[model samples]
Target: MRLVQVAQHADDLERAAAFYSALLGSEPTAVFDPPGLLFFDLGGVRLLLDRNAPTAVHYLYVDDLAAAIERIGDRAEVIGPPHRIFTHEDSTLGPAGHDEWQAFVRDSEGNTVGLVSFRAVA
Candidate 1:
């Protein structure tokens, strides 16, 4: 089965919206203020930001880890700097002969988010 939706805690919807919009490079798909819900379309999966939801750590794939971090400058607190995590020797988990890089940042609503990217071995 494929994944559908993931919810994360947000104390302020508007602040969360601005932070997410910049990091995702797109506006939210939908927003409801009365019940306090914000939605962003992540490759067909729904990313819901709710006032009552528990915080969750979600890892997002980026084309360029450094570029993504730069784009998110000052908006998010860089908890973990960019660094290589692993190398794929086979095509099972990731592309062969590529290194997996990851970085972590804290979102506006205080949720830790992981940013990931793969670069060919040099």
Candidate 2:
């Protein structure tokens, strides 16, 4: 299945926009002033930012989960350390001998963001 768009709500537009911009390292591809929305391009997925949408949880893929978390600075509160959630050799999410790790954090707006990465067996 292909995901076309994902949305998150923000009580404060400016704060949320700045927070996500720095956290994602990218600016919104589109923004609407009246409804107060910001959109980011996430590899073809349109990340919808608004003050009215229901709170949503999204996972972002990163090469180095730990470093990405650290780079988020103190604004993002770490909910959990990176843990092996899926191992191809043990589960069906991927091929054999590969591992998928995930870590959870709460963004400045209190939305849950998941950090995920794939690691080779060493």
Best-fitting candidate, measured by TM-score?
1
- For model 1 the local lDDT of residue 56 reads 93
lDDT of 1 by residue, 1-122 (tens): 99999999999999999999989999999999889999999999999999999999999999988888888778899999999999999999889999999999999999999999999999
TM-score of 1: 0.96
lDDT of 2 by residue, 1-122 (tens): 89999989877777777777877888778888887888899889998888889998998888888888877888788998899986777556655787889999988789999988889887
Deviating ranges (above 4 Å) for candidate 2: 90-92
Name model 1 segments beyond 4 Å from true. Answer: none
The candidate scoring highest on lDDT is: 1
For each candidate in turn, the TM-score is 0.96, 0.88
Q: In candidate 1, what residue range of length 10 has the lowest lDDT sum?
A: 65-74
What is the lDDT, from 0 to 100, of the residue 50 in candidate 1? 98
**Residue 85 of model 1, lDDT score:** 96
